[model samples]
Target: MLRARVELRELARDWRSWCKAIAEAAEKTLGSSRVYVFGSAAEGYATGGSDVDVLVVAGRLPRSFRLRGEIKARIEEEAGLPLYHPFEIHLATWKEAEANPIYREAIEKGKIINAQGLDSMKPIGESFGESRGRLPDRSLGQR
Candidate 1:
């Protein structure tokens, strides 16, 4: 039983590492855009089977399934993770993130980690709005 518990803990650590790597990869793929971790991964309750939840604030991505697929492929390749890794990515313009209730709530509830330098990245979502990747000026509990 003790051995099983240890193994489980180790597996969880691996997933966290994978999540960090994937986040970095996403930043690289999106260039000046920001990649954020939320849900299980951000709160640090991730387990081996847990899905890595991510939010991407970027410029308009082509609305093509093939292009999205290629982007994911690039992330996997850059992160050195297997293609089948459990990564669930939510994409939006920074303006969309600020205006959407769901995104605002998630940002409030989830801790933002500076895996990539925020200053180094440009606000790619200016086409959507002027604000960078900042959430709307509100707390999670208010709404």
Candidate 2:
């Protein structure tokens, strides 16, 4: 049980880093895009199996859901996220996010990662349940 918990903590840390990387990559790729993380990852409730929920709010997006998905895939690729990266990405335009109750709620509670560099943002993994001294290196993904 102790070993499982340790692995879970490591996995949670990896997920947080991956989410931050995705946000950074998206900001670089899409100048007007903003990224936010919600759900377990943002709230410090994540476990090894938890999915990092990310919301990408852009200035504009295609009307077709399929096209939006394609754009999201492109962002993930630009982020260099692995095929198995544990992220659940939601894309929306600022207007759409404002109009949707669920999205609005998420925005209110989520951690905005791309508004500025990660250095300015609080350490997400450090708040993961217990205090783990210093944060792990800001490396991109799973080691």
lDDT tens readout by residue for model 1, 4-111: 556545544565466567668877887655565667766667776666666766656767778887887887798887534466767766567778887765565554
Instruction: List per-prediction Cα lDDT, in the order shown.
Output: 0.60, 0.67
Clashing pairs in 1: none
TM-scores for all predictions: 0.61, 0.71
Backbone N/Cα/C clashes per model: 0, 0
Candidate 1 — which residues are off by over 4 angstroms?
1-12, 116-143
Clash pairs, candidate 2, are none
Error of 1 at 39 (Å): 1.2
When summed lDDT is taken over every stretch of 10 residues in candidate 1, the lowest stretch is 120-129
